[model samples]
Target: ALLKEMHAAGFEPNAATYNALLGDALQVGDFDQAWHIVDVMETTGPGIDFYTISILFKGYKGKRHSMDAASFDRTLGLIQTYSVKVDEVLVNVALEACVSLRDPHRLSATLATFKQCGWTLPKQCAMHTYATLIKAYGQTRQLDHAWKLWSEVTERKGLTPSEQLYGQMIDVLVTNNRLDDALQLFEEMKDVHGEHLDSQGFAVAYAMIIKGYAQQKECTKALQCYDQMKEHGTRLGLVVFNSLIDACSRVGDMDAAARLFR
Candidate 1:
């Protein structure tokens, strides 16, 4: 219909027009027709560009999330067969999907696919990519490899580990009962960037440390960390508040607990 309208109006349909049509097809659940449009673009002039490929990959990825495993793999196969240049955004999307799946075997397999295609984490890859992969490794209890990757990216690659990255590592460490290392990293975060740092990230790090200390029955240390938050005037979230309250209750500091509750 659109093509007929274009022809009637003598408006030459270009790549953008084809891409728009293809996107509409995907939007309406016509994957086969979308692929046909992709093929048309390949055979015609002005082949599929970066945006076109990104849209296709993004659409397939979104579709794959709700699909069964076989359908998901089929979508992945279609994406892999594309001959377009894969950018960091595309690779990041793939990594995020693998992480969301939470299957270490699938994660490793996707990584193997990356290896086969000569794709590595590019130096300019966004922090989220590194964070996602770190999280996947953490979920798999591959802490050593996770830390090695973190260190390589931060120290060697010269990427500044964002507070979220630090939070992720700390959370993973605390999960694995590596409280000592988690505390050390938490202190590093605090000492490196002293008081008055207003960020949700800092709040998260604080909560993790407080929770870990509380779990260890170090109520004094937990309260001390809580006090530090007050000193810095960093805004606290409900999660932190809950951790502190739990800490006080665990230590039978009913008075302190009530004070925090109020």
Candidate 2:
């Protein structure tokens, strides 16, 4: 109705105007309405731009779990059908959707499409981008690919890995059951990036290691990690406490579990 009013008022709606409506629809999870807008944009003038593509991908940001393959494919199809010029923001949004969906094939396809559209990681690309790609590979159980990206980021001259990057790498290693490797990287991250991490960062990094130990039934190591975490002034959270309690219970140490509970 507002669009009709705009037309009646001689105010022609362009890509930006439609992009706003598209963003609003996607933000509210009104994908049907969003798609209808996309259809209108297709039949109208002022065709889709990179911003339009980015907005479309952004709709799937936190809603990837509810997204189906067909929806994903349809969005990807837009890029080709409109020949949308790819940009870093658009590429990142698409990559994130692929990661959230845990679809390695689509992840690879997205990367390829970005390359075909002349998008490449800049020399000073954000560490978070590499971190996201590493996580995507990790989710797909492509450990080698994850490690390669990690090495690329770490080996880059004068580019320090962010705490989030370190955490994501550690998480990938631990999730792959490579506890020893995760621990080694954790130590490296502490030596280099520890001063930069706040109490919350310390808690998160320590939590991952502690939980990894607990999952392996190494209750002693988990407790030792908790001790170290406390020494770092990180207030213990419920996750850490629960993992410790479960670890103690798993080892048939009710007494230890009671002590932790207390």
Candidate 3:
């Protein structure tokens, strides 16, 4: 409100006003206004150019949200146009913007942006970037490469693998006809990350393992896994039972399958 009065009175807003506008847009994540303010500050003066660019990045973050996403390419174009001398925060935001794009080709190009900016991808940023890449790769039928990357990341130093991380690995294994590998990693997940696996996770993971074995024509293993899940109170839902029945029929265990249904 003070800023509007100052602008109206032919008194150009001060750095504080400019700073406030940029900050408010960020704190509240008003991306549309954030970008507008960025243009205004850059037009106003370079005294606050860096600060404005930083806010523009925040604006981009606001757009990362659904129902608020703007044109990422447009934001990227403007940022690159204005970032003749961008700093670390600007670079980080730009890389994050790439993650939000969820475009495999564009995201791949972000590696170059990191190189050009001389900025290290922070762990949070790296994890998300890798996750987006994994999803893209899976959709593009590049599952093997995604698995390879997942393995490398799992072995990285000073980084504990997360549920999402292990889940990605399990996804790759199951997709690639590697049921045994998925089961082994599921156990490894329990051993290495005790108390982290919740009931939902246990249920989901066991279901996938059963599905994988069924695909492999391994009925006995699937039934065993189902029993184990039930023992843990992760109720064996109807879908899992249906899958078990299918597996039993596939491997010539109709009697076992009948007993299961009863």
Q: What is the C-alpha lDDT of each candidate?
A: 0.74, 0.80, 0.65
Each candidate structure's count of clashing pairs = 0, 0, 0
What does candidate 3's lDDT look like per residue over 187-244, in tens digits?
A: 9877876574446656667777888888888899999988877667775777678789
Give per-model TM-scores.
0.68, 0.84, 0.55
Badly placed stretches (over 4 Å) of model 2 are 60-69, 235-242, 254-260
Write candidate 1's Cα lDDT for 1-262 as tens digits: 8777977998878988898888788777788787778777767635666567666656656665333355345445545665545566866666666566667787677667666666777767677777777777787788997898789877888876788888888888877778999988877776666542667778888888888887888888888888888887777888777888888888898798788756
Model 2 lDDT-worst window of ten: 60-69
Off by over 4 Å in 3: 7-19, 23-31, 47-64, 67-70, 84-97, 121-159, 168-184, 199-262
Rate residue 89 of model 1 by lDDT. Answer: 80
Residue runs of model 1 more than 4 Å from their true location after superposition: 1-15, 18-53, 56-75, 123-128, 158-160, 214-220, 242-259
Task: Order the candidate numbers by lDDT, best to worst.
Answer: 2, 1, 3
Candidate 2 C-alpha lDDT tens digits along 23-129: 89888888999888988888874877778888887776755445667777888888988888876667677777777677778877877777787777677777778
Judged by lDDT, which candidate is best?
2
